[model samples]
Target: MIFLKLSYISQSRLTGLFSLVILWTLSTNTWAQKIIRAPYIQLAKSNSVLIRYRTDQATLSEISISTDGKTFNPSIKSTNKVSEHTVAVSSLQANTKYYYRIHINDQVALGDSSYFFKTAPTVGSKDKISIFSVGDMAAGETQRKIYNAYVNRQKSNYTNLFITMGDNIYCGGSDGCWQEDFFNPYHAGPLLRQTALFPSTGNHDYDNQAFPYQQDDSNMAYYQNFTLPSQGELGGIPSNSEAYYSYDYGNVHLVVLDSYAWGKDNFRIFDQENNIQLNWLKEDLKATKQDWKIIYFHFPVYTKGTYDSDVSGEIIKLRDYLTRVFDEYGVDLVMSGHSHVYERSRPLREQYGLSSEFSPEKNWPFNSSGRYDGSDKSCAYVFQNVEPKKKGTTYVVNGCGGQTAAHRFNWPHPVMEYSLDKRGGSMAIDIEDNRLDAKFIDEEGEVLDQFTIFKEVNKITKKTINAYDPIELKASWPGPANSYVWSSGEKSQKINLRPLKTSTYTVTDTQKCLQDSFEITVNPPLGTTKWEELIHQPFESLEIYDLLGRTWKSIQKEGFIDQSVMDGLPTGQYILEYRLKGKSYTLKLIH
Candidate 1:
């Protein structure tokens, strides 16, 4: 009986050992399915967000999101059978913060406090919006410094979105390069995970080939990695393709174009007349009811950087083709990055010609200082929003996010008010009410340049005056002016003008550095003596008077009145007043 019992105990122990081996194997397998790339957030709308990640082996993806950071009751799962996973979570609140945890095959991967995102404000909301833009950002310490500069500068300030002005990945935008150059530096790090990215395609991002050529290239990774707002998913007209699209954030309408794809000769999307992208842009701009209109692309319309828009065929073509559309649609700002330098133009208009042909009067109608520096009391470029025609659009080339290249030609373009090629930097823009404030913050955390554009609600008044009337012209402004100069040689706030001939009087507020003009025309008095017969319509009442305020004649007559009617009248200058049904006309006539 003892031997039998010992045998039974040994069998039981063997069974226990076998069970431990099975548990160990299961644990090892779960550990082997490691998360190779950390999860990142994208496509952040007011009510939804897309979470993407990758693992070492094929595994299902799951995510749990919570607003309070604790009770993650809402869970999302992806059914795609692959290592790379993307799961979209929807039905969220706008302008709210959310905490999330990533899971691989139902196993927790990331459940830390750092994994959180703030949803964009509801569309058309009056909330103040801020955005950070960088271009050609490659993975390295330099890129980190630029990002850190932005973070340190805006520590207390939260950004609504982050924009990449193309060349997102360096040395061919492959999957590996995207991971190394983009994900690790910007996403895996703390700066970009919270904000959604809106990207434009640079030459490198388009694989150095045109869009048509890239359609068949299986190696093109940009389309594979990014889930952009095509099909009018966010707002504006549907672009139908990811190559070019637009979105609305708060009061701003942002249009992103594929400059490299459309700028090339063989693969150009615009033919100076019509194309899908051009037509889409036209319709999109026409449909946007937003207060501020901003457009961004890869190639610059005007720049004096390494790539000259004046000489390059592609750049010239794009500039000549795009500016007319921008002007027609009243675009407020044009942002681009391809020159690898920081350059900003003054409030410019009608600059579609060659660089040599740029005229201050024609291209730069608003040539005042756009810098917010207190040297000039005018801190912002004010545009009256009443007119369909835009006053001007400020073109900014903020390409120094990761690298800086010196200007090969003249350092400054004719329309440029500020140009800096010294160091790399990023751009931060804040939109509040009708004012937009932009600053170029360099890697050193210094604001290299700053400007503000204010959309004024009030309209400028235009007036016409008769000569010899001595009309008092008053400058209608709310603030005190240091000096005021009228084109008619008057240097006072109010000027009495009695011009003998037609003239245009331009008033310049030297303190505000703004100019406004009005025109006046002179007319001679009616001559004495009857030389011509009077012609009148049927049932019209006519009356005649002299310069001495003496009535000559009054009659309700029809048809032509011959010279016989004035035969008995005294030879003197006279005024003829004609009256019709609910209408009256005054004419200077000779008696």
Candidate 2:
């Protein structure tokens, strides 16, 4: 190639040299950056985030970060020339908002005040986190509506996190399908730039020509298109595989699993005793110490929506294998989306069988609507610290994020306390301390359903203390409750009492979200000190307890005890708990 002054070129030779110049001019267009796919955020952590984008041709990629939109730090540049670009920016403040921009070949391609993201809060931080999730949202107007609805509602409180329950793309999950159905809708201008996408795998994501569906686990478009917290960047055990992983946001531990059949192996997640995915999940669940544990995946363990959980193959297996693990670990929530509907269950446990075998009395140990709205025996599910590890788990089938209006027979499974299949919506979950609130926001921006769960709340206890002993009572439901009022008309978090006799006291929050009761019984000196005197007094109820705390005798009568009855008692140490003149008393007697 040669460039010479036009005037110096001879007329006969100008035509030959002109073709080279023309070719060079056309080749310059390739140098210009053509961003085919807009920038998206991913792999978010307390102090780092990953930004990924695609271009039409090879070009230099650079990213600039700033605390304010007007000012930016030195740009982070990658010299590698490639169509796909991933820039991981680290060494930042935790839970801090920052503006960013992408520069393709030294020109600003994406950046502004509106295009900013907030880093995840420090692990185990008390800061509140808002998460919005959708499932089976491939391509449709409904998907856009759901996205816009959440964005509109986020004006007052911005949430920078988003998750998907898979089937992210339609029609064989091709690269073009991903761009058209997924990347375009959440393109940089709308959501993807600000909100990090943490996605799970669905069968449709593995659908290749409908024949090789889920036949290639490592080669699926879903695995190729995104990078997640697979290396323990967010605080769980490093899975080293994208199939399943865990991430921590504030005090919440989010476990994303892959239940789809892996390539040609004809595998279920836990089909074998020593499966890699299952083993990773167990380690991840065991390793996370976050206050709230939530697991999300593609196939719902229990549902009677468009798909039947009772008869489905993988669904039944999920129920058989996963519930026991979740119960053993005290998993707070289990969310999935294969069925096309909205269904939520009461806190369930020991429920592993066909749908017809679902016994509410046996499965739902703490049964209630869990709406906390005072309608139809509605009460928040409580997780006591001393309760069994198999406390209860709330299973949610939120598959209708973009698809809806489908149902099977028995649309509302017996295990579910709330069910809705008329509209399409996504879930908005808010967590802070011991409380979690979730609402299903419909496409039209209406709240279709909502539920609340409280941990270590609404307690009742019985204590036996010596007379005039000081007993301190503390209210549960997280520290610094909205407002606390005790039965003694006190307005404090804790109260110390020195009662001469036994009495019952109760404390309730202003909103009545939680209540704690103390049934106090004042005990006399050891060894029948007051037994003789109390035997001649009238009492309402007398309870005789053995040294092992078992009730040996219970007499509910408004009469005095005779000496003959005391004499007839066997020789042993006993605890006498009797109410005399409306005041409870306890005495240790050796008969």
> All candidates' lDDT scores?
0.71, 0.75
Model 1 deviation from the true structure expressed as Cα RMSD, one decimal place: 19.1
| Model 2 per-residue lDDT tens digits across residues 60-143 | 667787886777777646645666666666677888877887887788887767778888899999788888888988578888
Ten residues in a row with the worst lDDT in model 1?
1-10
Over 4 Å off in model 2, which ranges? 1-30, 209-218, 263-266, 458-507, 516-591
Model 2 C-alpha lDDT versus the unseen true structure: 0.75
Work out the TM-score per prediction. Answer: 0.70, 0.75
Give me the runs in candidate 1 sitting further than 4 Å from their true place: 1-31, 208-212, 215-218, 262-266, 270-272, 387-390, 458-591
RMSD of each: 19.1, 16.8
